[model samples]
Target: MDSRRAFLKKTLISGTGMALSGSLMPQSLLAASSKKITILHTNDMHSRIEPFPDDGGTFANMGGMARRATLISEIRAKEPNVLLLDAGDIFQGTPYFNFYGGELEFKLMSKMKYDAATLGNHDFDNGMDGLLGQLPNASFNFISSNYDFSDTLLHNQFSAYKIFNKGGIKIGVFGLGIELEGLVAKENYGNTKYLDPIAVSREMVQQLKNKKCDLIICLSHLGYSYQSQKIDDRKLAAQVNGIDLIIGGHTHTFLDHPEEIINKDGHKTLINQVGWSGLKLGKIDFAFGKKNEISYANSEPLAII
Candidate 1:
């Protein structure tokens, strides 16, 4: 008789627990308490190891690699979920690149702990051989969804995409380069096939989404806009979907903040660029709150001067 009574009591308790659990809050509600993410990015640094000389130009005495390093370190110290990234054109500006053939550029960027970078037209100044020679110095990876390097020295050095995990949030980053037919010499980008950026970008975004990335970013050497009908960042954003941000280069455009555009799926996409020559460092703070939603986005352009 005692055993029968206990069994009935246990059944009632289990039913009550199941009923309560059925009304439990969703996972997003639990994510309401979490840390945020900050993304620091740059483009077209072009080997400007030191600040531009005090020649009375607009950017004179502004933009030195050391200053950028300090700024990045300070941010990382304060924010555990910080990502430092670059677009392209990491080489071929100052006497350093001319003298050392891109070795110093990779070394400095590695020191700065750049997560990933794309290829720029100017990166091929000394040809594929020169780029391959300096590849060993880079601690970070290279990403490019397009620009097939089959049958070339760079065939295995570059990856199509990479994923970074921070604070339980996943960020998928990829790269896209401009068409090389007219921009680069045949011998410079030898055996490299330039695929359609729009198509390649779509594929990458789908893959990133499959990986359940909270953020998807593209580092592109395509310019911001074009007077002609040539495809640029703006057009690319409109044509594609699932890319959260595009850090652009090649036109050296300076933007104080990111431009928001509606994508094919009608979602907001952001595009940002800092002028070339390492004159500006672009910083964007994205606060991820409940449900991994971006509660705030703040972008600042740092003057090297």
Candidate 2:
């Protein structure tokens, strides 16, 4: 147990390719002068309520909701300022969604105390009415900045963005979903207009900045990267400004650590995505200085064993 903790601590402190703009302060001074916030995230859960069976598979006996809950609880017990988030696809994969229709997933996420989550293409598998039916089970906020649900049954059901104040540090989180036209069946996402992600992201950033948020995060369901000119997380990070971190999903990209991309303003935007089926959890720690500026940041992807 001690060795495991040591391994996690080492991984967290020794994150590679982390982008920083300013000089880093001494550890002791930073600890005294800055406040630390730990962000824990997951993506593309796809209704894996229980861990994979031990059938000699790659992810066998891994990624159960119970284990995730225990791990999250342990972390929350140690860290006072912690945010738990998800980048969508919380529905449709296993038989659970077929039987429960996302009710179980939302209830479990609520049980795990998810702060916010976005929508994914697969999330619309059961259709708009299917998703709306399970909304009563979720306790957290569903943020979707780009997906316009004004003309659908889901109108006014989701927030464009949400601001959270954790220990006097203001954190703004918005969400962006993929273009669901061809991806999703037209009837599934009926009347839900897909807005331009880049444009919406810029607007969200400006609004969040105007609100004086210390940290800005985007819960993105737009896959990590793409070969063509698709607006994935990487493109969004490079094109949009003021988004400090983007927790992403889709394409099931397995990342050991967060990837850093320089935005239009030359500032660093970190993009992270864990593979599907709740196999891993992405964790990032940010330290804010007295002026509410991010002094340091690091990340690690925790394997759900």
Candidate topping lDDT: 2
What local lDDT score does residue 288 receive in model 2, on the 0 to 100 scale?
84
Model 2 lDDT per residue over 1-305, tens place = 55434433343344314543333556566456548988999999999977898999989999887778779989899788999999999998889899879887887788778999999999899899999988888889999999888899999999999999998899999999999988999999988888999999999999999999999999999898889999999999999988999999988998877888986589889888889999998888888887989888867688889
lDDT of 1 by residue, 23-89 (tens): 1334354334375677888889888877788899877878877777777888788778888888888
Clashing pairs in 1: 62-305, 63-304
lDDT of 1: 0.81
Every candidate's lDDT: 0.81, 0.87
List the candidate 1 regions with Cα displacement exceeding 4 Å. Answer: 1-33
Over 4 Å off, model 2: 1-33
Error of 1 at 11 (Å): 70
Say which candidate scores most in TM-score.
2
- Indicate the residue-level lDDT of 167 in model 1: 88
